[model samples]
Target: MNRKVTIIASNGNLFDAYKVFNIAAAAGASDDEVAIFFTFDGLNLIHKDLHQHLPVPAGKKHDLERFKKANVPSIPEMLQMIQEMNVKLIACQMSMNVMNVKKEDLVDGVDVGGAATFLDFAENADVSLTF
Candidate 1:
């Protein structure tokens, strides 16, 4: 019963976060326990206010507009899916402090802790990835 732990380290785009969530769900379905740790800019991924603020890919004519029209999953929706699948979402305590984020403002069911907590989970994970 090896586990998979993934830490989202970047806040590039919504698509990236979506991809990570999809991967985690697939792994969990296969019986590998999944955990997702949000750190650095990645912290925005779990914030209700900032989740939808990610850029929608620029240039390439109408790409951003078309993508928006396709009804992409909102960050909150993705987070809900992650929760429903029993994925562990951890908020980096250091990042939260630096960003002045209050625990009360975080998405529901998120566990708050520092790097050590994430490291402990990673150590036990049979597969670990930093995104």
Candidate 2:
């Protein structure tokens, strides 16, 4: 039987974003049903303009080169891959209001909703994670 995976993405840093996307992608590729809830600064991951330009954590600018050398996929590329793999991306409604982000600010195929929406998907999740 396929497992249900739910993820909460609450960090805005590039490193965290990379980890979340990578894990989500892997789970989806394994035929698990995956859902990512973007809250607080995590909403940046689904934003069209911001997702590609996320910053490394403070004083970690040097890691950019390391990521490149490791052949890490770009944020946009991962987003595309996850979408193609049928991963569900949800943006927090309250976070969007606080950040002044509109539905149009997100990439295509992202669902915009509140905590209840995510909880509905997460309630019976076989695996739950936070980033």
Worst 10 residues of 2 by lDDT: 55-64
Which portions of model 1 miss their true places by more than 4 Å? 64-72
lDDT of each: 0.74, 0.94
lDDT winner among the candidates? 2
Best by TM-score: 2
lDDT of candidate 1 over 14-88, digit per residue (tens): 666766776776776777778888887777777767776765545644655665698866667767877887888
C-alpha RMSD of candidate 1: 2.6
The Cα error of candidate 1 at residue 131, in Å, is: 1.2
Clashes in each model (backbone N, CA, C under 3 Å)? 0, 0
Per-residue lDDT over 1-131 for candidate 2, one digit per residue giving the tens place of the 0 to 100 score: 57999999999879889999999999988999999999999998988999989978889998889989999999999999999999999999999999899999899999989999999999999999999
